[model samples]
Target: MYTTRNSSSSCTQGGFNLGVMHIGAPACGMNAAVRSFVRNCIYRGDTVYGIHDGIDGLVEGNIQEMTWAEVTGWVGQGGAFLGTKRTLPEKHLDQVAARLREYKLHSLMIVGGFEAYHALLQMYEARGKYPEFCIPMVVIPSTISNNVPGSDFSLGCDTALNEITEICDRIRQSAQGTKRRVFVVETMGGYCGYLATLAGLAGGADAAYIFEEQFGIQELQLDVYHMAAKMAEGVQRGLVLRNEKANENYTTDFIFRVYSEEGKGIFSCRKNVLGHMQQGGSPSVFDRNMGTKMAAKAVTWLTDQMLAHRREDGSVFCDEASTAVLLGLQRRSYVFQPVIELKCQTDWDRRIPLNQWWLKLRPLLRILAKHEAAYHEEGITVKEVEEALD
Candidate 1:
C-alpha cells in the first residue's frame, strides 16, 4: 500500500481535519471516493468528517467524523452512501462557512456533479468575507452526465455508459426478433449529449441527436429516409439514440411518431425513455478504480495545499485565486484546476462544459453509422482518439 502522508513537502506537516460531502445527484463511484478519502486522511493521522446531505446537512450539523472500517468494502458500491442533494449552497453559503469553522476542517472535498462545482465556486468567491471558506476545497467530478468542466472524464460516466449499452443490447435483441423495427431511445445527460453520442457508437445506432448538434424537422425526416433506405437494403433492426434535453421541439415521443409515420409498412417503431435505472447499478470496474485514485490524489493534494498555506496563527491562508479547485483527469494526469478558472470553460446556464470532448467524436460516430456526411480525410487517428478521450 502507498503511504498516505507525503514526506517530501517543503513545509512542516501536522495533523489536520478535512471534511467530505456529496452534492448533486447520486453517482455510482461516489462511495468509492468517500472510502478512499477517509482512509487516506486516517492513515495520515488526520481527522476526516462525513457531511451528510450536502450543504443543507452541513448547516444542520449532520456531519460526523468518519472511521476507517466504515469505508472498507465501499469500492464496488453504487450511488452515494453519504447521501446527496442538488441544492446549491448560494442561500446557505454563510451557514456552510459557519459549519466549516465549527468543524475546524483544514480542507474540504466535494464529490458529485456540476452543482458541486458551482457550490464550491460560490464559497471560494465569498472567501474574502469568511475565513472559513478559505480552505483547500476540492471537487471530484462524479456525475454520470460527464458535464463538469476542467475534466475530460467524470467518475460515474463510464458506469452510466455501460448501463446504457447493456439496455440498448436488450432493446436491440427485442428489435432483432422483428422483421423491421426502429427504436428511439432517450438517455439522460441534461443538455449535454456525451452519453447519447458514445452510446450510439457502442450500440450501433443509426443516428444520434444531441443538443450540441442542432437538428430540425427536416433533419429528422432526412434521418427517417436514411433509415428507410437501410431497411430497404435488408437491414432489419435500427436504433436511434437521442439526448433527453436535446431540443424542446424534438422529443423522444415525437421522434417515435415521426419514425412510425415515415416508415409505414417499411418498419415498426418503439420508444424507450430510460429513467433512473441509468443511475442505478454496481459501479463498473473503471469507475471504481477512477474514484479510488481520484480520491487518494485529491486527499494528498488538498493536504499539501493546506500545509503550504498554513499561517503562523494556525489558520489556513485563503488564496482566492487557488483555493477551491476541481480534481479532473487530463489525459491520465491528475489536474487540480482552480474552480474560478473554469468559468470561461463552463456553460453556467446549461451546467455543461463549453468545450465538450465527446462532440469531436460525433463525426466518427456518424461515419461508423453510415450517415451521409463526409468527415475530414484524417478519419480520427489513434492520437486524436486518445486526445479526444482526454
Candidate 2:
C-alpha cells in the first residue's frame, strides 16, 4: 500500500512503487502468492506495498510497504494474511484512483478470484476517466473454482481438488466397508464445475455433476441406474460428486433420496455437503511452487514493462504491458492476458469464463463414469448424445 508515505518520489528513487493485495474469498496459497510478490519485487530493487484488502480497503487507505522479513515462513500458509473483500471498483472508482495517486503505485498486482478480477476490470475500463489507473496491473488467478478467464488453471484449484479427492477417499472407505452403499458428495465451486469434474477424475467417482453441462431428472435417473448397475456388478461402493450449483432442481440430497428409493433392495444412500472446509487447510506443495513462480513472473513482467515504457519525463508510455492483465497458466506455458480482452471470454451472468477449456473434459468424466448413454440403449443416436454433452 505505502499509501500517504511521504509522496511518490521517496519510494520511487530506487525503483517503482508496486502494490500487492488479496481480494475476494480466501483460499490456500494466497499468502504464499503475496509473499512471493513482495519478495520478488523487493529483490528486483522495487518497493512493494501490501494493500490491506481489496478495492474497498484501498479507499480506506490501509496500505503499507512490506519488508522481506515480514513474509518469513509464509510459503505453505493459507488464507488471506493481508485481509480481503469482494467489493467491486465501480462505485468507488474515484476513491480508488485517489489512493492510487496518493500511494504512487507504479504497478498493482491483485491475487484472488473472479471478484477481484471483475473489480480491477472496472478500473481498467475507466483508465481514460482516471489517469492514476493507467499503470500496469495484473491478477494472479487464485480461485479454487479455476473459472477465471484466459487461465487453464487457477492457484488454489489443485489444492481444492486434492481436498475433495481426499474426502471422497474417506467416504469411499466407509461405503466400501458397508458394501452396496452410495455416497453423494457435494463440493463448492459456485456455478463452475472444475472442482467437481477434476475430483471425479482423481477419485474415480462413478458420477460427477457440474453446472457447465446441465443435468436434469433424466440424467439423475440414468445416474441412479448406473449406481444400481455398479452394485449389481458386485462393486463394493459407489461415489457421486455434485458441484454445489450444478443444477437448480437437482441437489445432493435430492439425488441421494432418488438413489435410495430406486435401490431400495440393493443399496443405501448418504449425502455430504463439503461446505467451506474445502477452502481451508495449507496449500499443496504444487500450489506453493506455482504461486512462487507466478508471482515472480508477474513482478518481472510488470517491472520490465514499466521500465521499457518509462520516459525522460518520468511518465510511462502505455503499451501492451501497461494494460491490465491476468497471469494464467495456459497449457504448458504461463501467459499474461489483458483483463479487458477477457470480456468476451466471460459469461457476465455467471461470473465465469465462457467456453471453459475444462468444460470439454466433463463429457469424458461422464463417459468414464459409465453413465447410461444412448450407446447402451436402442434407437438413440450415441453421437448425438455425446455431442449434446459438454
Candidate 3:
C-alpha cells in the first residue's frame, strides 16, 4: 500500500500542480531535493503534490498536497521524506496517467538515478499509447553510487564518499597499530566503481579494485605482491579499497585469504565491508547546496514549461507531448538534456558505458595516487596533472 507523509487541504487555488517523487535506491539529500522543489513551487505560486513511494504511489493514487512550511529544516535530513520505491512507472503507465489526471499534475519532478531515467524513456515511448501521460518531467540524479550518466557528480555522492573515507581512515589507523597488517575494505558501488575509486583516492589507499578496471587472479596476485613489497619497505600498514562488484571471481574473503594465508604470515589481513552504512548519513554541505541548486534548476525548467502551456485566461493548455529532461552537472557545469539521450545499448551482462570524463578520470586517480610526490618534486602539482587529464 502507498502512504503519504503529511496530508493537507486540496490545492484548488493552483497555478501549476507539480508532482514530485523519489525513485530507485534511497540516498542522502533526497529530502533536500524535495524540500527545495516544494519551496520553489510554492514561491512561484504553484501547487505541489508529494507522490508517496515513488511511481507506485502514483499508480495507486496515493498523493498529498505539500507546502513550503511543512518541509522546513529538511535540507540536512537523509533519505526520502515522501518515501521511495524501486518500481518503474512504465509498468503502470495507464494507471499513472490516470493518477496524474486525477490530481491535475502538469509536471513531475523525478528525484532518482539510472532507473528513473530509464523509466522516463519508457514513458516517452508509451506516449502514443497513453496520451494523458504527456506530462513534462525532470530527473534529478541522486545516487550514492554516482553511476548516473551525463553527470560528473550526483547528489549524495559526497556524503557517501565521506562515510566510506571515514571508515577507511579508521581501518587504516588500526592497520598502522598492528604490525604487518593490510586492510581490505569493501565499498558499495554496484557495477560502477565511482564510490570505491573516489574513496580510495581520498582515503590514501594503497590500491583500489574497481569494476572499471578488469580484475582477475593475475591482477590480484600483482596487487598482493605490491602491498607485500610496500610492507617490506617498512610501510607497516596498507589499505586496499575494493568495489563490491569489482570481479565475479574474486571475493573479499578470497582476497583476504590470498594476503593472509598465501603471503605466508607476511601480513595480517582484515576485511571491513562498508555496506548500506555508506548510503546512510546526514548530507554534507556540498550535497545540500548541490541538491538545492539542481532542484532549483529543475523547478525553473518546469515553470518555463508551465508558462508555455498557460492560456490567455490563466488556464493551462495541456500540450500533446511534454518535454522530459534530466538535470545534471556535466563537466562541472549545470546542464539539462533530454532523458532519451541517456539510453544506450547494453551488453549481455547489462553493462553500459559510463561518462567519458569518468573513464578518463579513472586512470588519472591511479597516477595521482602513485606519483603525487614525484610530480610535486618536478614542480607539477596534482591540480595541474588533473587539468591535463581533463
Which candidate should be chosen as best, given TM-score against the real structure? 1
lDDT of 2: 0.81
State which candidate has the highest lDDT: 1
Q: Rate the local accuracy (lDDT) of all candidates.
A: 0.86, 0.81, 0.76
Q: Which stretches of candidate 3 lie over 4 Å from their true place?
A: 1-14, 311-322, 345-353, 368-389
Evaluate model 2: give its TM-score: 0.90
For residue 383, model 2's alpha carbon misses the true position, in angstroms, by 11
Tell me the tens digit of each residue's lDDT in model 3 across 95-161: 8878877887788899987777777777777777776556677888889988777677888989999
Q: Name the runs in model 1 displaced over 4 angstroms.
A: 1-7, 10-14, 373-390
**Model 1: residue 286 alpha-carbon error in angstroms:** 0.8
Task: Give the per-residue lDDT of model 1 (tens digit) for 348-375.
Answer: 8888888976787776676677764423
Alpha-carbon shift of residue 130 in model 3 (angstroms)? 1.4
Candidate 2 C-alpha error for residue 259, in Å:
1.1
Model 2 misplaced regions, further than 4 Å? 1-13, 313-322, 372-390
